[model samples]
Target: MQRAGNAFVDLIDDVFDNYRQFQHSNDFQQYTSWAKQFKSKLSHALNTWIPKASAFVLNLLSKLRTSMTAWWFFLDHPEVPPDNNLAERSLRLAVTKRKVSGGSRYN
Candidate 1:
C-alpha cells in the first residue's frame, strides 16, 4: 500500500514537471513573438504617440504589454484583450493561500 501511494505521488510529480516544462516553452515562444512586436511598437510610439500624449499613451501601452505577456484576452464575440490579468492574479493568490493553509485534504 505504501509503495503504491508513493508511486502515485511520484507519477503526479512527473506530470507536474512535464506540465511546467511545456508551459515554460510555450510562454517563451509567445514572449519572443511579443518582443518582436514590442520593438516595432516602441518605434511607432516614439515617432507618433509620444509627442502628442507621451505619458498617457506610454502608460496605456505599458498596461497593454503586461496584459499581452499574461495572455490576457476577452472571451466575448469579438475577443478583445487585457482580460486574463485578474484571473491569473487570483490563481496565484489561491496558490499562496493554499501554501499558508498547508494544502487541502484532497491534495
Candidate 2:
C-alpha cells in the first residue's frame, strides 16, 4: 500500500513537472499529448491499485474517480492551474484569524 501510494504521488509529480515545462515553452500540443498519456496512466493505476487498496485508500480512490473530470480541467484551459495552492494560500490569513478568534457570536 505504501509502495502504491508512493508511486501515485510520483506519477502526479511527474505530470506536474511536465506541465510546468510545457507551460514555460507555451507548447499546447505537447501538453495535450502528455495529458492523454496521464489520463491513461491514471486510469491504469486506479484500476490496478484500487482492487488491492484498504478501506481508507479505497475511499480516497472513490472520491478521485468521481471527481476525475475536475482533476483534469486544467488541461483543457491554459489559464487554469493544476492545483489550488494559490487560492489556499490566499485564504490562509483569513483562516488563521478565524481560528485565533474562535467562534463569532454574530454568526
Candidate 3:
C-alpha cells in the first residue's frame, strides 16, 4: 500500500513537471498531445489499480474516474487554476464569519 501510494505520487509529479514545461514554453500543441497521453495513462492506471485498491483508495479512484474531465480542466484552460487555493482563500472570511455566528439561518 505504501509503495503504491509513493508510485502514484511520483507519477503525478512527473505529469506536473511536463505541464510546467508546456506552460513555460506556451506550447499548446505539445500540451494537447500530452493531455491525450495523460488521459490514456490515467485511465490505464485507474483500471490497473482500482480492482486491487482498498476501500478508501477505491473511493478516491472512483471519484477521480467520475470527475476526470473537471480534474484536467486546468490543462485545457490555462486560466483555470489547477488548485483551489484561491477559491479556498476567498471563502476563509465567510467561513470564519459563519463559525462565529453559529452558522447562518439563510443561505
List per-prediction Cα lDDT, in the order shown. Answer: 0.48, 0.85, 0.81
Clashing residue pairs, backbone N/CA/C < 3 A, model 3: none
Q: Candidate 2 clashing pairs?
A: none
As a TM-score, model 2 comes out at 0.80
lDDT per residue as tens, model 1, 1-107: 34433543554454345335544575555444554554455445434543344566566545644564343322111123223466888799889998999888673
* 1-107: candidate 2 lDDT, tens digit per residue: 99889979998898789878987998898888888888889888888898999999999987888899887787677578888899999999988888899944475
Instruction: Give, for candidate 2, the lowest lDDT window spanning 10 residues.
Output: 98-107
Give candidate 3 misplaced runs (Cα > 4 Å).
85-107
Candidate 3 local lDDT, residue 74: 71
Task: Show the lowest summed lDDT stretch of 10 residues, model 3.
Answer: 74-83
TM-score of 1: 0.27
Output the worst ten-in-a-row residue range by lDDT, candidate 1.
Answer: 73-82
Q: What TM-score fits each model?
A: 0.27, 0.80, 0.72
The true-versus-predicted C-alpha distance at residue 88 of model 1, in Å, is 11
Better of 1 and 3 by lDDT: 3
Task: Give one clash count per candidate, in the order shown.
Answer: 0, 0, 0
lDDT of 3 by residue, 1-107 (tens): 67668767876886778777876998888877887887788788888888989999999988988998887787677656567889999999999999999998886
